[model samples]
Target: METTPFFIFLFIHLSCLVLGFGSVMVTDLYGLMWIRDRVRFTQVISVSGVTEKFIWAGWIGMVAAGIPLIILKGEIDNLMTIKLFFVALIAINGIILHFLHKKVGKYKKGEHVPNLFMFRLMLSLFVSQLSWWGALLIGFLHRHVTTIINWPDMPWLVSGLILGAFLMIWGLGEIYFKVKEV
Candidate 1:
């Protein structure tokens, strides 16, 4: 096995992960502060706007690097499939978040934002975080654990996550609306 190419792509992949996840974490933190009334909504929007570039840069880089990594690895196992699933979900969620940000950006700091829109925004954020974390975890397990322990097949793992994410999204929306009502 020619490890040089694999190691190069791995480094690139890890770098992109750090950039994307770090930017996302910052954006989510800002959003949390806004939701808690500790920061102005405008500030959150501003931060998100700025961080979006870095996020996309990292995303694009990851895809670019991932192709070579996959090729070098010479096979996609169940775990790799799970990681790919999460990557796809993250890409789709990012598109939704882009539009949601555009819609939400119109409101002033103290102005009313519709419950539906707010819920969607929260949902998008949740999806983004979940997908990123899922991909990261799957990647780690694929690299480090699959050989050491027997793992469930792709459908089982993915289905379980889908169910869990669905429930969490519903609960998060309920909590967001209830907090707003208070």
Candidate 2:
């Protein structure tokens, strides 16, 4: 791999990570602010609406740059596989979050948000944090301490267990909200 191309791809990859993850972090902070009554739901939605573009741009660019980096480096191990799985989960979760954002946007000021919506939003936030941070951690480990860390043998099983736990949490949330309403 040429040094110039490798550096270029790495730069784009890092830039995308910062842009996307930074936007997501800001949006989550605003959501927490709303939950804490430090800000309004409308304000949180506004910030999310604005930052969504950057989030998507960062995700897309990161993925685009990642393929070349993988090829250039020619290092694919169990950890890399796990990271890729996490990236795919992020994409899937992003789509679900986008729709949830749309649903949240429909409420007028002062209207009570539904319990289900709140629960789902919380679930999405949890999943987002898990996927994003998990991917970041896996990438860092693979890049920095490849020889030290012992990655799991079955990457699919690991991915499945992580996603399954998230889904279970979401299902439990749904049940809790339903029971509360009853």
Please tell me which predicted candidate would have the highest TM-score against the true structure.
2
Tens digits of per-residue lDDT for model 2 on 20-43? 999999999999888899998889
Q: Model 1 segments beyond 4 Å from truth?
A: 147-150, 154-182
User: How well does candidate 1 match the true structure in TM-score terms?
Assistant: 0.83
Q: Which 10-residue window in model 2 sums to the lowest lDDT?
A: 142-151
Q: Model 1: which ten-residue window has the lowest total lDDT?
A: 147-156
For candidate 2, the clash count comes to: 0
Q: lDDT of each structure? A: 0.82, 0.87
- Cα error, residue 158 of model 1, in Å, equals 3.2
The collision pairs in model 2 are: none
Clashes of each: 0, 0
Task: State the lDDT of candidate 1 residue by residue for 102-128, as single tens digits.
Answer: 988888767888786778887788878
